[model samples]
Target chain A: MDYKQLQGRLRSNILKMHHGAGSGHIGCSLSCIDIMAAILKFKNEADTFILSKGHAATALYTILNETGAIPDEDLGTFYKNATTLPAHPAPLKYAAIPFATGSLGHGLPLATGIAKANKLKGNDKISFVLMSDGETNEGTSWEAAHFAVANKLDNLIAFVDCNGLQGFGNTADILGNTASPKLWEAMGFEVVECDGHDIEALMQAWKKLAANKNGKPKMVVASTVKGKGIKEMEDKMEWHYLPMTDAQYTAAKQEIRAGYGLEND
Target chain B: MRKHFSEYIERNLADREDFVFITGDLGYNALEGVAKKMGPRFINAGVAEQNMIGVAAGMASQGFQVLCYSIAPFVVYRCLEQMRNDVCFHNLPVYIAGNGGGYGYGIMGSSHHAIEDIATLSGLPNMQCYIPGFVEDMRATMDEMFARRRPAYLRLGLGKNLPADMQLVTGGTQTVLTPEARLTILSQGPVTNNLIAALAKSDKQNSIDVFTLNTMPFVTLPAALATSIATTKNILVIEEHISIGGLGSSLALLVNEAGLPLDKFISLHAEGYPNGLYGSQAYHQQVSGLGEENILRVINSYF
Candidate 1:
């Protein structure tokens, strides 16, 4: 598969969704798009993925649309009143979303439990959870980390989208070194660092983690720009909250096309 | 109550392979047998209640009947959002067993008291709160929780043994005495034990009726309890929990909806740290006006 082309398509869909809704975590969704794409490509039917940082539901919904897990019309209903695709993910609203996780710090513990259950049931299912760097500030994340290590959940893999920015400001300035690889390693996870937007790097990281049978939960600390892909929006705190204006949307589309060499599209 | 809960799990583990128990570093002597039998299936989730609840929700999503156990405050107050969003919203088969409901952890101060657990938990969508009023009611409560296969809260506390003559009505509502009395004293949890003891010694027991409500967020008033309330226009609602959103509030709504006339209604509930003093459970009950003497005083006032 042409991952660069796929990334452009996902970026376009995500921007369109946010633009249509007139509200969403556009930058936050942008930061984790490639990570989601990588996991979707690598994971099997036995595996389960939980979007713990639920503010970025648009990103997950866009990817689910690409996979045909949800109909295109359902994707159109994102962020509308009483829509299944709310600003945060609702459990069983879509086939792939197993838990309602818009609240930060919830996904890791849930992932640990799923991994533990799979181990007890003698199933070789890997539980994957995607979280934001800001979400690590929640105490439950550390608690889950300790539990995952204590129980030796080798079947669990965590992805931290280190976007550097959060709702307030830069994550480091707010909560210093919250989701660092060192912290995860100290918490007993086998940690891997990579460029989050580089789909190949994420894929390689996933491969390394999945190959290990070392009874330690795995973490991928993917360094990423908060508003990746769009030149003006990348790493800007304002993009996290701002929906695109018509002019901004036009410019962003051009940038995405030019960046991925999809001028024809 | 904790012993009965442990016994229920130990007894049912043989037939229920899908059962998984997770505790938030509680159950010192009571759950050791459960741990031994279930092995890896039994999880001591450290002292992290939030993580424990989230874990329970996750396991439940995978078709396991998961139970998360801890002290009432630790389990209910600490991870309320997880309980609401993860467990209840999904309608997962995750049972939260909270020991020491209301002022059961007396002398430990307000932090240990779960005075509002019933209201907070019962308010959530797709969640049922069960307060087993007697030691014998634990098995039936657990059975109902599992049979329903949804999110539930089991509040465990100090409960008296049921006297041989008295029988628990269907749905665990028991009418201890005087079914057609002019005044109906509707109580919840182990607090009903104090009411029963108070009524047994009272010379005017025949003038007042006593009914214990164990399950909360009831869809409708239990048939017999409704009949009693309808016949007896005067009602006294008692609970260890706070007056708001507890049995008192719920029953009041149900009674009004059922169009049962009420000449007078009174609610006696946990007053919290009235004097900011920590003491035994009995002492707290006394201070909160939930003791046997005060209960009898209120029952007698109706006459």
Candidate 2:
């Protein structure tokens, strides 16, 4: 299947995984699926991206499975005791992952360090770091921002998944919302805006902005509804982690299977 | 120690590629010439202490030996968790230089005073705490700290310069007032000088040995030295930090760990200040009972 088909299937699978576990950040994870797909398509490399905002791993693990980073049997044991896929998406819990996740605002600076090492060692592989809009509340994020721009680390790309909700409450109430696009622009980044769910649009933006190898860092402000696929989940804060019930799970599966024409697993 | 350590930084920059000097956007006015000579290795991480520490940690992970410069509290307390987790957890052979210890920033008020650092730092595990007394001790401790690829906290003083060849280092003991008394007094950094001067003014014919603890995580205080100190009716611990969790306490813990006996453990620590202003490096000792008179009083109390 093409990238678009894979992206859609992954979004559907994210909800299904969260259904099995009875818990997940379905909304935020669903929105970032397409963005992850776009970057994977553009980079065309073996090393995988790391989710700095690890809370969104429900969807991330789902995509990793769809891409064969995890086998179908392995996906069944997510978040269970003795299972590698703990709640916050520990990287390489499965073979293909890179590093552990969960603590937000850490991945970009780390990725920048990795990129710098590659540059010094004369390696051409790239690393991507994805974070939620709420993770920007940390000063370390700004510190990393300044360092990356100043250091001229061009190989690193960071995505601020602008789902607009933080753990404590709404992002605006806690830190206040001003334009993120303008903020990144002032920080000396090549900032681009795109539909977070549109794999095609996101892929285009990634190629245009990030493909340039000559030392400018790129950030994509991916605007997306928190819960994208399921009917009641879109834009609902209640669905951030509260899982769909068995009845709701059966209903969701029926809807997904009906529309996609798949043999129900 | 300042001149010697600064000189080492100067020479290293000329010799090694990865060695770098980082400052707190303060206190290079004294070493302008050396800084100019060692331009590439020097980095001023600015007043943002936490950010500077994280930056240092990041740079260190890439095989750079980052010598972070700042006042004691700025280095130790303000970015405490970051220092503990990011720097020590990674064990990235970076050296931290705390220029003003205890009340070094005496004029700046309590905020600048690093009186609480020793308590917090000594327990961080796998790190060395160097509380240098004389300028020569600075070289001895720094030479060891820099040579080993481990994290270290160097608590320094803005005190007097010593003779160039003065050889007492981390491993060796010195004759500060020319050992005349049988009783021995042990202290580190500026406190050592203050303790010596206190004994002289008291005018007792003395054969006391003044051993400066240059390297900390002080291994079992030597048996001969412990016996010498035990022979004395008094053992005084003087530090410019808080009476709680400072040098005296560290020594006490070391003595306990070594199962050595102490006749007396006297601590001269914070008593606020003559003026309430913080970060006053000079008046710190006088105000906090680390002054010569107070130290003498603690010694005389035992006699």
Candidate 3:
């Protein structure tokens, strides 16, 4: 699959699904598609992934569909009451998802326990936890980070889609973001910075961390625009989850297709 | 009866396989040596209470007996939601062990005291609580509970008047000191001993019966020598916890629901927020009082 081409399809699919479901963090969902797709193809582990930021579940389901983890037809059931894809992503809906995470700062702690459990049981399945910048402020996140470091959870890797915006406003404004890198570093873990929109960079960073057996947990901070690939909504918090009208949907879909050179396909 | 539960917990080092203990920064010297002995079973989850509960829930989900330990307000109040949704909702066995219960940290002021712990905790569904009246009860609870129930919360006193040995701690039985009396002084935890002492001093010890309840959740309400409330016409419920959902309120509900018509019943319990940042043991004594002296006074007034 073409990196940019697949991203375009995922982007349109997310917008349609979120709008159809009338729920979700639409902007963040569109921003993190590349990282999700690249991990599925490159990581080559039992392919364990958990969406720590449960609000952006549209992006998760879209990528799952692209990887044939879910049928494209079931995408319509995104957030319906009877549907498996409720407002927060339920792992039981898809085998690839190892756990459910929507309660802020929960994913890392649960993942840390799962990782520690796996180590005790002598399993090497890598648990890739995809989180949001907003979730870092929860004490549980840091607590789990320290646990992961103390226990030397090399089988675990965390990806922070640093989109900079949360529900209330800028993360920096709500809580100063100066000491996160320093805090984690002091806890004895390696850190990496990458462009979230650049699938090749994310895939490469993951590959490097996979080779390091030094027994330290790894964190990759990927800077991203909330609405990447959708020019009209880029960085606009107003589109955080504002439903796209049918006309707006047509226009946005057309623009997404044109952006990735799929106007005629 | 002064039973130091730490000694028992220290002996059962390998039991941690099914038991996971998480703590705040406290009990550093006290718990560290034995905890580290558990190797992978022990975790100092830092001062994050909310996260600690969630981590315990995670461990429980994976088949580990998890115990999240901290001070009362830290574990009971700061992380109430996590306690409710994660631990309680799943009905998993996660023990919440809190230090400085009641006036244990009275010198530490209202902030450290845990007067309302039972009031708040007992209200939750499937939450079994224990306020060990003496060290013997603590030893028995720690020993028997591991093989029986996996999850519970234990409020430990400040080691002031612990049971000198295991004599008083029975295998889940409410110890009876007096029988068939007009006044029944019902209570639990460290404060309960103080009440019995008060009775001994008053010489009304013969007239007043004392029952020490170590078993909790009020489910195992001891079938005592039931004095007909219609004949005695009096039952005084006392505890270190708040009168609200504490021992008094629990008994009241059971009695009222069963329609046990007692002529007079009084709850000699606490009032006010015990979370005083002020440091002093006197603060707890002032707020909750030491024991049955105040309760006896209330019961005498009723007579």
Candidate 4:
């Protein structure tokens, strides 16, 4: 798959879903779309992915729909009454999702275990756990970080959607200088820094980490702007929880079309 | 109890290919054999209880009968939300073996004690609470847990004081020391040892029956317990845990639901914090009103 095209489509779908669903994490979801696109590009049948920052269910649902793991029609029912696609990701209801995660700091530990299980079974499926910058503040995430290294879980690759903002405030304000790359490196991870919105850079990082086998887990600290595709909501805190209004949705679509060179409808 | 549990794990690992044991850097002397035998299957998840539970759930998700071993407080209290979300909510077959139930690690101070574990863990849905007072009970309960393949918490008290005639009742009660008595005293774990000793020394030893329940958070009362409750005027519950949510509270609920009337339904169990008591398990038991003398006094008050 052409990751740039997929990123554009994922961004468009995310905007539409936030507007249609009437409630979703639009900004944070948009921040990780390109990173997720790069992952989906290289993700094989053996590979499994977990979205630890589960408020971005719309982004994951859109990507799954694009990948054909989930039906396209189900995307329309996003966040609607009696819909399997709720505001948070429920993997049991959707086969594309592997683990149900919304609570912060759970994804890495669960992913570590999954990688461990795969190792025990002699399966080489690389378990990918995508977390948020704010999610790193949880103590459990650090525990998993330490455990992953101690167990030599080289098959696990963690992606930090370093959007810089959290639920309450900027991650810098809440947790000063969390510096995920340095933190992960100190915890014995082969840390890589990248522009999260740059699909080529993310794919390159994924390739290097997937092939590297130095007995240390890999972490890609992808620096990103919250609500990256749209100008109005970029790095704004309110967009974390707010769905796009009709005007905001129209503006976002036009911005994406203009920036990504999509044919204007 | 730890010795038998470790022996069982070692024996099972020889045959069961799917069994995985995880610990939070605990089981100092007891787990080395299991670790050596199982190799990579036995994982010490460090002191991180929350991550240990998540790891167990992850292993269990892939057709593994995972066992998480730790002290009662560390496993139950430290990682309750993980157990609820990762294990119980998903209904994974993860057997959490808590080594020090109640005041089993009493001299290690209040932090090591696990008095409120029963109350906290019992409230979770799809969870079975098992308190094994003897090695036989541990074997029987482990077999039942393995057969059932559900989420269970096995409370392992450190003290090994098994009553000579303590019957291994599967998912029910056992009349250990005294049977066919009009007055019944019920409890779980090694606390039953004190009850047994008290009953044996009492003048009304034949009149006061001593029964031990191996499992709790159960639906229906065992026929023997129900029958005992029907005939008894005085029923006393002595647990090493707190009064609110341990065996005492569960039995009260059963008695109320069964509509069994009695002159006295006394619950002699611990209540509130230990106030930084760093003494032996015996001292904690005495202060908590679960000592031999306290048991005899409560029995004499009614019987």
State which candidate has the highest TM-score.
1
Give candidate 2 misplaced runs (Cα > 4 Å): A4-51, A57-127, A198-204, A213-215, A227-233, A238-263, B1-3, B20-24, B27-47, B159-186, B202-209, B215-234, B257-263, B273-280
**Number of the top candidate by DockQ?**
1
Q: In order, how many clashes per candidate?
A: 0, 21, 25, 0
Ranking by DockQ: 1, 4, 3, 2
Quote the true-contact fraction of every model. 0.79, 0.09, 0.34, 0.46
Q: Give the chain B TM-score for each candidate.
A: 0.96, 0.85, 0.85, 0.93
- Put the candidates in lDDT order, highest first: 1, 4, 3, 2
How well is each residue in A223-247 modelled by candidate 3, as lDDT tens digits?
A: 8898887788888888776877778
Name the weakest run of 10 consecutive residues (lDDT summed) in model 1 chain A: A256-265
RMSD of each: 1.5, 4.9, 4.7, 2.5
- Grade the docking of candidate 4: medium
Candidate 3 accuracy as TM-score? 0.80
- For TM-score, candidate 2 versus 3, the one ahead is 3
Question: What are the per-residue Cα lDDT tens digits for candidate 2 across A218-256?
Answer: 788888778766677777777776778889877776765
Top candidate by lDDT: 1
Q: After superposition, how far is residue A32 of candidate 1 from its true place, in Å?
A: 0.9
In TM-score terms, candidate 2 sits at: 0.79
